[model samples]
Target: MAIGDILVDVQAVAKHYGDGETRVDALRQVDLQVRAGEVIALLGPSGSGKTTLLNIIGCILDPSSGRVMLDGEPVFDGKWLRSDLRRLRLDKIGFIFQAHNLLPFLTAAENVSLVLDLAGWPADKGKERARELLDYLEVGHRAGVKPALLSGGEAQRVAIARALANRPRIILADEPTAALDSKRAQLVMDLLRKLATEQEASILTVTHDEKIFDRFDRLIHLRDGRLVDE
Candidate 1:
């Protein structure tokens, strides 16, 4: 798709748990659109459904009611449109977390290469792709090191590389800078913005880090399970 194309199209999505009296609404009529090359920060207080919305967009969780389109294809309409949700996620979406969830035993490069492996790329080609991502993220020098040996920033960089391994059109990051200091958080947001521009990818970052708020192209506010203007 072109750089200005809408990569994510979420229409009146709602997510609720339990029934009637016991029902708890996590999201209510949430509609969102993320264009390619855009960087947006999703902000909200605790229990405001930020993660729920992100998970729904990532296809990791299903919504109670809504329709979703990714890369111009309908993926969900109350039920998943594609039977192979895993394959859809691998092909179109990337995810990063606050914890920098890297494999304990694998080197940084291996962690990245694993995504390509899952996507059915040849092992050697996967490794080369991992190397390229690590180099682009400026973590190539530490690619052979285990996660335990890296600093928080370094590990998160590795995680970012892993997220980029499949050339995904959209990246959903949940509190990616929560564990970092102010300076590091700012740096990470800057990196994300640069990645969005250079890769022409859409990035929706769920964050409470006011320090890095200015780095985003736009800020999306979530309150009481609904989106609101700043």
Candidate 2:
């Protein structure tokens, strides 16, 4: 891809935990580039560092060595600027985890609006956006419902709406479909693909479900903490 098309670039990145005898190399000279409007899947077995790499790219963790560039701007250069990292993560990146992580007491709309509230969005605007997102995700009927009242698929859809609330440039999802049934998993993957194309966002998702593998624009494999295929 051309330089201008790249939204995320990871260059020779490495991560290590502990030191000496207890040290574990979580990543090894990993290089990856994600372009705008692309959906890439990171496939690997458990403990293969998929989540580690996702965390690094999402600015949730620091790499021991190497660089990261987001939208042509350097975000990591051997050291992380904590404040900048936090700001960029909120403004430019969205994250989804295995769990919906919704605040159980909050209504669906309220849960989605919380993210906008953190970004300093006006209350009315945030609420409007939240509703729009929920509607778009086909969860509008559950806007006033709490997580405890929604089905698994409905809850996941709300989580996705919240993730897209900020219109982030990139999205990092770790096992986003793990809790869903096959049909729901396919629905989620299809939504992700649609988001990539319609929103022009780069998405990197880590998943072990081979059934949904064909939904991705590209597949990346990790083994022994290293990227073995792209």
Candidate 3:
């Protein structure tokens, strides 16, 4: 991808936990670049640093060394600037996890609206945006339903709508379809790919499910905390 197309750039990044004898290298000189409108799958076995790398990219964790750039701006340079990093995570990055992690008490629209609220959007505007996202995700009818009332697929779609609530440029998903059946997993992957194209968002998803590999624009392999040729 061209330099201008790059949404996220991780240059020779490394992460080490603890110190001295107890120190463990979670990542080693990992380099990755994700461009806009692309869906990339991060494939690796357990303890391969997939989650660690994703967390670093998502601004949830800082690398021990190297730099991370978002939209051509440095977000992490050895140390993460707390104020700026928090804002960047809220405004530019969206995250999805293995579980839906929805607020059980809130309705679908409300669950999505909560994110906009945290971003300082006005109440009326947040509610409107939430409804719009639900409608777009084909879950408008379930807007008033609570998490317990929605099916697994519907809840997952709502969770996706929530991730898109901030209109983030980059999305980091960790095993988003791990709990779903094969058919449901396919549906979720299809929706994610569609979102990447239609929303022009860059998505880096960490997944162990090989069944959904074909849905990604690229597959990045990680082994022993280092990126390997695919």
Once fitted onto the true fold, the runs of candidate 3 whose alpha carbons sit more than 4 angstroms away are 1-4
The lDDT of each candidate is 0.93, 0.91, 0.90
Worst 10 residues of 2 by lDDT: 1-10
List where candidate 2 sits over 4 angstroms from the true fold. 1-4
Residues 1-230, model 2: lDDT tens digits = 33239999999999999998999999999999999989999998888889999999998888999999987788888887456677788788988878988899899999999999999999999999999999999999999999999998999999999889999889999889999999999999999989888888999999989899999988999988899988
- Winner by lDDT: 1
The collision pairs in model 1 are: none
Instruction: List the candidates' TM-scores in order.
Output: 0.97, 0.96, 0.95
Model 2: lDDT to the true structure: 0.91
* True-vs-predicted CA distance for residue 43, candidate 1, Å: 0.7
Name the lDDT of candidate 1: 0.93
lDDT tens digits, residue span 1-230, model 3: 33238999999999999999999999999999888888999998999999999999998887999999986778888887556677788898888878889999999999999999999999999999999999988999999999999988889889999999998889999999998999999998998888887777899999999999999989999988999966
Residue-level error in angstroms, candidate 1, position 199: 1.3
Ranking by TM-score: 1, 2, 3
Please report, as a residue range, the 10-residue window in candidate 3 with the lowest summed lDDT: 1-10
